[model samples]
Target: MVGDALASSPGGYLLVLAVLVPVIGMLAMPVMGLLRVRHAASLAFATIAVGVAVVGAVGWRVVGSGEALVYGIGGWSPPLGLALRADGLSAVMMAMAALVIALVALYARPQFAAAETAPGGRRAFGFWALLMGLWSALNLAFVGEDLFNLFVALELLTFAAVPLVCLDGTAATLEAALRYLVFALVGSVLYLLGVAVLYARYGTLDIGLLHELAYPDFATHAAIALMIGGLMAKAALFPLHLWLPPAHAGAPAPASAVLSALVVKAPFFIIVRLWFDVLPGASHEAAARALAMLGAAAILVCSVVALRQARLKLMIAYSTVAQVGYLFLMFQLTIEPGVPAWATIGWTGGMLQLVSHALAKAAMFLAAGLIAEALGHDRIDELAGAGRAVPVSLFAFGLAGLSLMGLPPSGGFIAKLLLLSAATLSGAWWIAVVISVGGLLAAAYVTRVLKRAMAPPPEGIVTSPVARSRELAALALALCAVALGLVPLQPFDLLAIGRAGVALP
Candidate 1:
């Protein structure tokens, strides 16, 4: 059945192309020269459009057929050669990444445009090329099957991302970028060490092969713990988050949006793959509980810290950390035996939370960027009456905030609802309580910003106009998050379509 699906599926080749196409463009950028950089943006948009179409087509296949699409590399099957697989979750992530990339590219043109006279400058070329590189690396990370291969993709992602943080070369931003690079490198070292142990024990790096072999030895458990812990540090989960706020808040607006919305997610996704796919039944429940506890700490501590931030960008950065905590709640909610088959709701809910947070946070960061660009700063206290100056940006911020707060008719609401239901069914009352408190904290932070935005300008306050197009782009992404709420409340069979062949605990 898997072979038949592979033979018929177009997504396999498309998956490879999705990762390579942007990289090819990145390599071609220097040759194109500065006068042609604008065309590079157009090329990027076109490539992303093609990628999204392919992913959408694959999503249709998954939903229609209720199965995954898999392609054996070199026709050599797993354990000997690498394979690429896409289920509903991978499809959604690919599409979401494409959409966010396209939007950021569009929004960047005005902000990143170089003067015709100075077209060949460093900023313009560097930004465009690095953007493409970042896109390629991210797609590769999503579809990669081998642990070592994924480490390469992760390194690519980090390299592409770090320079973006320090693009301006300002002292403060450079410092933040250095901090990020060091911490992420530490994470990579730990992750690579874990992969080495796994390969030593199992003789294969492919996830499918590892799943089939089911390494239940002490080496396997230790490797899984190390890999997951490394990923958590890279993902900025709580204590390891020392590098996040500064790096994210200090970057340029477009850079900040991408870093916050998509970059951190790659590591978190890897951790999910580790625990759920590779390790499966071997996962230590105690360890999972410890991870969830840290997530809960992140929620309570970071949400309060976000509320206390004086700057809009920093508040959003801290909010990203808090939102990340919610994704871990699934560990506790989805692990119980005798749980209804419908309990996959928690898994789907976690994914929806990831997708919606990406879209909404991207929009919020971009809106904050526009505000900062107009007023020359993002001071929350000074934002009074700023909404009148940039109503569209303000509206975009509010709409995105609605999703973050888990309000009705938004993806965040549905995600929280599913998670809460799972918690109730499993009798994990604390998960439900934490989720509820997180929502309220979200509401508090969002409302604080909205209230200040809508109020009359304080005496002596001043504001300037922001670009309408950028504001609209942000609003569009926020609207997508709102639209995700329309998906029906169910087990979300699509996510499970490809899992039957893979051994699950």
Candidate 2:
């Protein structure tokens, strides 16, 4: 299987650095003997900025040349060594993760400030380090060309993420973290089982190679089922979503943002690669429809659950489950015989939803955090004065809600509209109906919070003012979500990049 390395792209090395920089920064924190809060924060942000730059360069190269940036490790071809490949999807996702993480880091700085008297003064350092580690893992997941390498990335992501959920070390947060760890491990085991099955059957784990080699065999079918099922568990889709709400609502807002916005999406990303790129034909149409139906269930059930929440954070957390369902709905709509999945409207629609939701949900969570801080609690009924106390954050929250509601001029609007159109065009009436109802349900929950927030303060409720920087960070993310709608209604060619022989989006 080892041979002449696939011809390297002009900027392919950047792909390796994209994954390595954060790992290096995470490691260097100890090596450089600079774990102080100030030093940690500075190092983390600088590394993230560099990561963003690298992602931008990769995106430019991919979009300019219309191909993937691939680097075979040590100039060795796959099956002997590993390869890192960055396509348009990786570029966009890497950039999005970097930007969201940077904003989250800024938002978290004051919250995680190390106490002078705390043991070893590690709170702040831990936060920054874990953030960097998570970033590294996310980049690795996005660019990983092998199932085993992606497994390693997924494990790293879980390790870094679980700690963030319980940064305060409270019993409740600890319990939530433990629950997350346990379920995520279940996912890992299943994924690994499928990986082992695939490797044993085909003698390779490279995704591109598997795409060509895999056939409609029992082992192929079983591995795809197990792998996709495992990924869904990690992704916290409906029915398997029990661990997400408490973990997200209980974690610090910044951690919640990272978890909800980026981490969950990583497993889902791999699931997509497995289905559409690697084992598309091995999985039957019933499987895709089943996934879409589960998504529809998540949307309907979780939206109602979110609406019932009295706490702002809980509401946002449940809403995340609801929104995540939309990602799965695209599966049935995008994959039809003789059509490259990437060429379908569902492809762009689903990906845009992922990006837009990341930005919007991060903004909403930050805004919720700001509100919680201002009021000393997150009781929705008592948030009457929040609009007056933190108008910027409140505005940010509302703007993000607009996206979640699929309102016009927001990325969510374009994304859902495209998906809904795809469903209708493809004669999937039930899917179109579900998408419509999900949007309405999303609007209901968002407005429920907005209504309470907009109410006048009840007899002088107390509220602390939010810092301008924190408020701006939230607003910036919300705006990015809104701005995603500016891409023309027609197919976005940039999103279609590197999907060889696929019709343009």
Best by the TM-score measure: 2
Q: State model 2's lDDT.
A: 0.88
Q: How far is candidate 1 from the true structure (C-alpha RMSD, Å)?
A: 3.0
Clashing pairs in 2: none
Q: Estimate, for each residue in 1-505, the C-alpha lDDT of model 1 and write its tens digit.
A: 3453433355567667767788877876665655454455555566667666766776776667666666666655667677777776677777888889888877887777773237444676677788889988888888888899899989999999999999888999999999999999999999999999988887999987788886577888888888887888789998899899999999888889899899999998888788778884633668767877888889899999999999999999999999999888777666756443224787878888899999999999999998887777899987877787788888889989988989988999999899889888878788888889999999999999999888987687677677788989999988998998999987676566676532322
Q: Model 2, which residues run further than 4 Å from truth?
A: 1-7, 34-38, 115-120, 280-283, 503-505
The C-alpha local distance difference test score for the whole of candidate 1 amounts to: 0.82
Residue 455, candidate 1: Cα error in Å is 1.1
Instruction: Give the TM-score of each candidate.
Output: 0.93, 0.96
Cα lDDT tens digits, model 2, 1-505, are: 2343464566778898999999888987766554443466677778888888888888888888888888887877788878888888888898899889988888887776664236634777788889999999999999999999999999999999999999889999999999999999999999999999999999999998898898888888899899988999899999999999999999888989999999999999999899877884533678889999999999999999999998999999999999999999988988656767777888889999999999999999999999898988999877888888889999999999999999988999999999999899889999999999999999999988889888888895777777889999999999999999887775567777777765543
lDDT of 1 at 216: 77
